[model samples]
Target chain A: MSHVYERVALIGLGLIAGSMGLAMKAHGLAGEVVGTARSKDTRDVAVGLGLCDRVTETAAEAAKDADLVVLAVPVGAMGAIAAEIAPHLKPGATVTDVGSVKKHVVEAVSPHLPDTVHFVPGHPLAGTEHSGPHAGFATLFENRWCLLITDAGCEAGAVANLRALWEGMGANVEEMDADHHDLVLAVTSHTPHLIAYTMVGVADDLRRVTDSEVIKYSAAGFRDFTRIAASDPTMWRDVFLTNKEATLEILGRFTEELFALQRAIRTGDGEQLFDYFTRTRAIRRGIIEAGQDTEAPDFGRGTSRK
Target chain B: MSHVYERVALIGLGLIAGSMGLAMKAHGLAGEVVGTARSKDTRDVAVGLGLCDRVTETAAEAAKDADLVVLAVPVGAMGAIAAEIAPHLKPGATVTDVGSVKKHVVEAVSPHLPDTVHFVPGHPLAGTEHSGPHAGFATLFENRWCLLITDAGCEAGAVANLRALWEGMGANVEEMDADHHDLVLAVTSHTPHLIAYTMVGVADDLRRVTDSEVIKYSAAGFRDFTRIAASDPTMWRDVFLTNKEATLEILGRFTEELFALQRAIRTGDGEQLFDYFTRTRAIRRGIIEAGQDTEAPDFGRGTSRK
Candidate 1:
């Protein structure tokens, strides 16, 4: 509702950027939206989807005369995108990113920013297994968290302005140190994703190629893992590569914990298993009570309007 | 529905049996439906919810004149319940169970059945995280699979009649040997439930002692695991204990495959990780295409419906 920026340039037309376009439209918050993608096809598609007021083929072209620029590409691509758009960035333009791994993006992007330009790296804690321009919607950010990470010592006014912009999009903005952001995300997102990938991968290697069997019997518990494992491969690949240390660290802890549970199961320690399962149920209730998701059984399987 | 059983008795008041009661009522599939639970609280609730046409405090009282009896209890309690009700079962009553693990339940209850009885073990591969008599819905079995197992060579006509009852409830029924059903479910349901329980327990521990952050930022991916982890603790505890061997076997396969993927991530083998993630996506697509679930992201978070 407040005037935050005069012009906004989105430097990638993938899921995040595409979603940003829709969100900005919903709030009528941005002055002018310019979008760009590296590939010609994506550029054409972004324009065709009317994701922006004007579409360009290069980040430099999009950021020209822009008051704010958001990098919504993969973590590995943040630095180059920052560099490319740096030359054309308007003086005093505020730059932020929507990559999942914040520390990597901050470190990669902050150093290349001009002294006059503000670089505030952010990781919007929202996404879906879906990708591409068509997969986005104006409400993707509604009620989700947007974690902003930076050690750039940018102006408090700039950070507040960014916060207001996200709030307008219905996101709860939280400020966290970039490294801490990466560490938290490593456990919450990266490790869960790895586990899902592995389980589905294990099923894939079965000699029977029992695809229909797996699907038909998925209500048995395998379906949830499959949904997460179905996320964009390119996005996940970039995540693992860029956030390697934190991911490996959490995984190390996870493996140790997993082994102890395995030992209990092997030794027929039903009490231990029961206690843990009982304790885990409380957390699920907390999540549901927190209004992050549903409280219905099997998410109201028979009642869901799917 | 065919005149398969002159009367059928259901001995449980939870989601499985309650759904059976509602579905039978919906289709006029059963001749008479009598139900009971160990606790009078559940009996009162069952009667109030109309989950059974008649409710009794003891399983034997309900099964006294029934031509078919279904045991729908926690696997740990199956034997005791079967024993208490066995003497009262009508001559030639077909005895069956609706437990997730088939082998142990069949082993526990079938031996107690009278020579005049036909024992069949079955698992309806459909359920929600919710339980209790009030949680059941008439449409719960629609499009779901139900596996029936028997090594006793129960009459083909009896099996067909049983299959017809499930079909009337909107389930597709298949018959498999008890051991095979146990192994298949061990891999698909039991192991996955344990993994989810362990994962949620780890996060709960983290949230309590370390990261108040573990849950505040849960959606990064940890929340999906919580849904499975929220499942009935008593039920899952019994599953792991009763189906230990098969659960452990599938867990071993899962961890081995997981380690391979972990090594690939550590080595920056992007191609390997990408290939694995990509392959798993196909599996998810196959699941969706098979009509097991929707392609919607996290039950279509952005959409109004799941």
Candidate 2:
């Protein structure tokens, strides 16, 4: 099938944007990909790596005449990027994003958009612990879900075109309301990241565990937390700041349940602990069935530090 | 180097026991490896899989005339297994275990031990979500840690020999008082496992998450919890039940910390959350540098998860 857009503009060429640029180039999904970054060093590296056909320092300069524009900055920076590029965007351009939180993005960017263009807010549910243009790859989005959140009054044709662009990059696409999307993600992504970061931090502070012992035994369960905790601090800082209500709600529920389990352990309530352990197993099976993640072996690629 | 034990007997041929049997067989570290199981079906499976040279139903029967007898059963059953085998064990036989909790195992097994026999309680900090004899492999203990805990006047040479046996099975051996081991592990493993089980259970109880979204979006983070919660239910039940005090103490601290972070999020305390996130990244790096775990391309494996 022929590629959809003649020119694709990526504002903020970090991991997500650079990855999209690589996927677009490898799949022939975009005729020309233009990218911009906040720092000159990043733009130089992106240009050197050929992540895009052209690299610029300003969002508006990069978005000039582009058929599609993806706002790929951190959540807190969305409004600023939107404002910078609003005056330069081509008429009828389809604008979307690769942010983790959708409602916040919609609320932040929609007001700055031109009525002539299609604003379809999206989130590609994919990433690794690494960041920056150097960390991206052509197959980064393969087999992952790219969720787009838009409303009834928006241009359905434009949503279809954005969906096609993501599908061409090997991502399965789905749509949901912006608010529901934020809540779903707060459970699946945002809250979990916060909990993991907190747990790892707690372990780090415990004198009895000794930094050596904690790390040595991390494979038991704590290693999983570390991987998530190692994620970009700036990105997550914005995530929690913007998705506050949803994250706090889920986190509140998690603590209530965690305390109950703690009480069970203290009182030696084996039945309650056993029942909880058993119920959670079914969720893992469902994930396998959904074909959303790995089942038996280590969840990710198995390369470990020597 | 020459092999350590001439005849090694394994009591309870489940995942750890079976894996040890396979590792010994692969390395030719033992002249004969016999195993015991409570059920006839398990005995049959063990023999069929060649996990043992001889399979029996009674721990005493397996310990008879053996040079080394290793208890790899649920923690709750350790005392009974120790009592049953003490009288029948060969004079000078070395006994060890792979229980998660250490102090209880020592208390349960030490008093029942005959003077001629040496009892060294151990915990191999390695395993997968899988269970049963079929999950056994020779490499399961490779590069893993086996914490041996005891303060009893067991002979120094005896402990050395047991350490040799574990190292032969591809483990690094460390020593600590059983109580300290329990305290250390509660923070590192037990508390984390309990929290994971509880969080996933909470999601499971909510009808909205269970009907579909939780499983679909679990890849974002919740799936990691399921992988942990799926750990052998009986094994974890015994872990919490046996290591009650330490588990509860660490858990109390965790809830307090989790609550503080929750307040930070609710009140938009970005600095608090950011500091916690930043501090935790060092622990992951410490783990990699310590060689306790790997942090290469795909969790030390080659490629990333699909």
> Taking the tens digit of each residue's C-alpha lDDT, what string does model 1 give over A212-263?
5666677778888888899999889999998999898878878888898889
In angstroms, give how far residue B170 of model 2 lies from its true place.
1.2
Q: lDDT values of the candidates?
A: 0.82, 0.83
Q: Relative to the unseen true structure, what is the C-alpha lDDT of residue A108 in candidate 1, on a scale of 0 to 100?
A: 87
Q: Tens digit of lDDT per residue, candidate 1, span B1-306?
A: 554566889999899999988888878888788999878888899888878888887888988999889999999899998899888988777888899888888788977888888887888988988888887888888888989885557787678778888888889898888777777777567877777777776677667644567777788788888988888888988988888888888889989988887888789999998888898888888788878877776676533410
Instruction: Candidate 1: list runs displaced more than 4 Å.
Output: A1-3, A207-211, A301-306, B1-4, B150-152, B209-211, B302-306
Chain B TM-score, candidates in order:
0.95, 0.95
Model 2, B95-160: lDDT tens digits are 899999998888888899899998888999888787888878778888888888757686787899
For model 2, what is the alpha-carbon lDDT of residue B75? 96
Most accurate candidate by DockQ: 1
Which ranges of candidate 2 are over 4 A from the true structure? A207-211, A300-306, B207-210, B297-306
Error of 1 at B177 (Å): 1.9
TM-score of candidate 1 versus the correct structure, residues matched by position: 0.96
